[model samples]
Target: MAARTHGPATTSTWAPPSGKPPLASRIMRATWRGLPAKRYDVGWEPGLRVPAADGGPLMTDHYFPRAEGDFPTLLVRSPYGRGLPWSPMYGVLFAEQGFHVVLQSCRGTGGSGGGFDLWRNEAADGRATVSWLREQPWFDGSLGTVGPSYLGYVQWALAADPPPELKAMVVQVGLHDPHALFHAHGALNLETALAVGTGMTYQHRGMAAFVKATLRLQRRLGEATTAQPLRGAHVAALGGEVPWLDEVMTHPDAEDVYWNGASLGEVAERHRVPTSLITGWHDALADQTFEQYDRLRRAGCETSVLVGPWTHTSALQQGWPEVFAESLAWLRAHLYGDPSGLRPTRVRVHVGGADVGGADEWRDMEDWPPAAVVGPWFATARKDLTRQAPADRAPLASFRYDPGDPTPSLGGPLLSRTAGSRDNRTLEARDDVLTFTGPPLTEPLDVLGPVSARLSVSTDTGHADVFTRLCDVDPQGRSVNVCDGLGRLRTDGQEASDVTVPMSQTAHRFAVGHRVRWQISGGAHPRFARNPGNGESPVDATAFAPVRITLHAGSALMLAAPADGAGPDTAANG
Candidate 1:
């Protein structure tokens, strides 16, 4: 998971250099011709001071359409600073689309006064900013919120008490649960935390400083992640102690009082704001977006979701055209009473193609996880996946997991350049990994919803972690990951137990001749901190041990396929 990143890049293909309208126009025309045409020249105001709840001045930048007409405001709050992508993409380009865009740095970053404390002050500062907006002469009393990554978290924080002026929201690759972001099912998501720490510590300083910090982290990552006492291991990469990172890392327990009020997911249930949730299949926070959509939909709030085949950063780069268009449509329909641009369907997802088969295309649906039927592919001692049930109870596979040499994590849903689907032959070859391969499919199998693995297993050590993955294996034997998840096990001393590991949601097509695969591993290292194979806290453990894990034949891979025509495909005939 090296080179993992969060938020928009300092520079973007969508955001051209300032003072060069010709270059910007040419780039947009060449790459994003489908977007709505620019309607106004943008006006900019830098170094505006907006007071926080406690009178601490927060640095802000306001970008508006130069014309005299009243326009809806787009409030973008981010801790990553107001420059590059934020200015050109959100400030300039969006302003050109006939909206007033206010880009503000969060408290204690980007020249804003006060200490940054992660999720603590966002709600208060958001309210304060809205209060400030009301006093502005140009404000038209209608507001919409938009941003990505941490920027999205700020939107959720603001929605804790949805301002009367807030008519719509677009949360791209957003996060709601701070606990889930850093820890997955009790194991620490080590690499993402480190990358995020680097971003928070240096991004506001300037691009050069941020790049330097990122390079330093990459150089020292091996040393930091392998440190004896995993706690405080990030000091070297981060250049210094980041209190919030330290706090979150140490407090892995979601129920800890230390995390009180850290999650703002409940806000979605309470508000009826027209919201658009955007995420990539491989984005680290894609599950969060799915959760947001589910909550919003269940509450009968007007909502839609767009999922693309991209990683966290790529969603803003390679997928920017579609992302920007979807965002503009949602904002226009909700904030400006113009629904013409809105798509007829509530869901749009990019169904991925296999190396040799499956159609690569965008699909529109009335709702997400669109009426899928659950099908189980049972694992066998022969290392084959089949629709038939196990004949009898037996150990299907066994592997030794050594903490000294843990299984390395390959690409899939990480926040890195290396994130997303990648050939998994190297990973599947590891001694600690057990793979079950299904027969080549005769027909395309479209899996469009959540995938999970139900395993009956026992570990020599009472403590272990299970990492299960679903993959698409093409004709030439290239096994690429689609979705995966990690779950920690705590059993009563070597006793067999049943544990279900949710592999998350995915929209993918397993084409003809492509075989489905279920890969099981003891752990995916640095993507998750190596379990010390003891009961001790993974973060604080200094002693390491080797553990042997066994999987029973009854274990099965569960996939959600469309109720019609989508199911476990039978073996292709000779």
Candidate 2:
């Protein structure tokens, strides 16, 4: 889509055809029927023009309580357009809850003037919107921000130079670093990048356009991921050249000049706005949310976090009730001067049970990580995971990863439909993937906090990627993923390399009769762009090589056991 510049236009109200709700009232009623009782009738005025920093239009929709005297306002700026999910879900619903909701389309989207330049213009554009709010008659100066994904990013952008009226923020499944989203551990997150590109390209157009674009991407995914040069391979799947995708893919280094000022994480350290962060354990941006929480806590900012079991999208759908309640509580406590709705704890996480006799309930705590006991379970030559150290320092396992036939990615943290925990029995059966299974637990074991794998590995190519995962094998012999991470290995001199692969964080309980399994592989293809097995960049490589990886016996999986000593301290086979 070509960029368009528009002269300022008079604010106009747009009504739904047939003079009814934008969507049929019954559909809206059914969708949110279980939510809190409506407090007011929603009044909407669409197509309000808020001038950007450069005088271009930032098209907005105003959802207000029809009988409101004065109320706090919530600002939600998004590039995905103010339709479908956003219209009724955020604009109308939040408005009915007694807050004036201004849902605006980011510049260059949804009839907004000026070309969208990704993250470059958000800070200035957001500040301009707040300035516009100050002139409105209903502006009572009590303000908060809430939304998910890019919407969360915009909140951070605004927090960088927070206006005086800004009181609170709720960032759900948010990310502060775009670089980390596209490139993690020095490899492209190919699938997520493509999915994001597709959404940005067509989602603003409408649901049909977005759905069609997604289908096209799905059809061409295999071909695009396998193309030799890798540079222009995504054009076919993405429908056209996505300049930002190309720029990010080509520049893998986070410190590269191309990514300067792209990360807004510093805002968390500098600002003291009471922020509530929500993310799912399987959400693609879970790590970012953790980072946000840590920074905000360290800066002495009043902050709270809620981690659930849903993925990036599901957090807004299936997890909406919980997410909405958490968000509304935070906004009410800060914006409405009512702490009655707030929870007593600053941290809350949903412990995943998954058909096992585990703690499948919401846990509240004073802080994150909660002082868990750290323990290491070692890998053995017999393909066993035990707290008992290996008797001898010997080679534990070996696998050859061929980039031409790279190991495929299964369910885990991802943006697409194939995200969240999946049975890993098939993935573990792959020749390139090695699994070290612990004996069936005699009792239920709960793992909370961060997980990591410390490996003493040697690769024939001296350059490869290591993918480490922690899984829960049920009594039925089903291996399901919990959390996983990928680390890049590039060494020329060491006989063996000791590297730490962060498996992000998780709150899960392993049931009685379940087993703990540590799975290791050279690469999770297309999940983390295939490693070329040489020093060459995966994107620019036209040649591929295979790497034989050897795992030393002393390598171990480190986990954070609950602080209460409520679980097993050692892995013992039943």
Candidate 3:
């Protein structure tokens, strides 16, 4: 689809205001002044307050051009302060593209005066914000939303209500279920979650207070104090102390509260907006994006999904420009009555591995799960090694899991820092990790979606931990982790086991010279809270001795593989 434009301009007409100022003010003024000077004229207007459903007033900052015409509004509802760098960047860019951009600090955040309650009040507040935007003097009554992570979660929350003015949305790396995201994976993911959560706390207090408090905390308690205290406080102060975080630690089972907040499946069926979701293939939350995409398609919602070879911060790093372009095209088509090459259903992904030259490519399909594949791979274990193939009987393998020196996290989607350069060679050397591989492939094998492993296992103790990793063993013998999945084992059925644990999906091509391998282990430390190997005790129990875990090779650790001729056909036309 293509939209018509008037014509190209031939002029050097726009100029910004002249001034020098403090850094933060300079950054803000530059953004406010420079963004409009190029293609859009940015101007701020005050007195915008929408009444929350509960009678509280919700404050908002509106950014639009001086043009004397009504245009659709692009709304961003964030718990983080609206003036923050990441939040404002989206507002400036979207405003430059001709939408009336409104950035509202949700509930207690920023200039908004209220106590924060996480996602509880977002639905009503978001609807109130949209209704207010629709009634504005220059509003066209059409609205679209965009944001990453927490901000993205608000978009979904608002859409779940199907607000009349809401038309479409772009959500990047947002949480679908708080339980699954923050705790369900049987590990803390403490660093990344805290980095984001504490960042929000810092934003809520303005820059000055945030920095002052930060320095004081550092001096009093040491540099790590700021991050750790916030995390500890969040867990301790959780309403009802619902044991939300602790339950995640103690009960790794997906029951009760964990299932309550998981929203992707529900949002897909309830929200009717045309949506675009972007997530990193390596992201800890990548499963949410994929599951949401599938649910949306099955529910008959218009949607597009993109998974790239980037990490969690892809939006600010190497892939941002392209991500921006795609998002802009979607907004233009739906918001501005312009449509140029926006597809109805597609999943474009960046393929990673030593082969395929590491590039992104688009793939179109009528539905997710692709309709052309079969899932069949069984676990095969011999000695201490495990593999996946068709199996009619059981297999076993064994390893010891020591809580003190548990496996450490290398790199993945949930990590705060970049582990791009770190290799997995050292991790493979540990006795606790079980590694298996197929002979070097004779041709390129492109893996482009979610992966799962099935294991028939029994532990020496009543409980155990399982970590399954997919890796690429290069011709040089280096093993690089591409994707991984994990589960905590409790054999008495108090917790779930034997079920397939889905790992994060990825796009990678295994070259003829490389080997496709799976590494099964007990834990990945720091990235996940350590699984104190004392079988039946609560995770917080401090006293425990390590236990030995055994995997029966004749029947356990099955690797599921694509059916015959079900792999990607490189012989076909690209």
Give a tens-digit lDDT track for model 2, residues 60-85.
Answer: 98887765256789999999988888
What is candidate 1's lDDT per residue for 1-574, written digit by digit as tens? 0222223422222232233233443354445545667898766777899999999999998887766556778999988888755677788778899887889999999999998989999999999999999887777788999999999999999998889999999999999988999999999999999988998888888778988999998899888888888999889788998988988999999999998999988888887889999999999999999999999999999999999888999999988888999999899888778887888889888877632433357777888877888999999999999999988668888999998898999998888777998999999998899999999999988888999999999999889999999999989999999999999998766667899999999978888999999999989888899899988888899999899999987899999878975432321111
Ranking by TM-score: 2, 1, 3
> Which ranges of candidate 3 are over 4 A from the true structure?
1-38, 46-49, 185-188, 206-264, 343-345, 354-366, 372-396, 419-422, 492-499, 535-539, 554-574
Give candidate 3's whole-model lDDT.
Answer: 0.62
Q: In lDDT terms, how accurate is model 2? A: 0.86
Candidate 1 vs candidate 2: which has greater TM-score?
A: 2
- What's the lDDT for residue 44 in model 3? 57
lDDT per residue for candidate 3 within 315-404, as digits (tens), equals 545666657777776777777667664755466665576334544454444444442333433344533232344444343556788866
The per-candidate count of clashes, in order, stands at 1, 0, 25
CA-lDDT, candidates in order = 0.86, 0.86, 0.62
| Span of 10 residues, lowest total lDDT, candidate 2 | 1-10
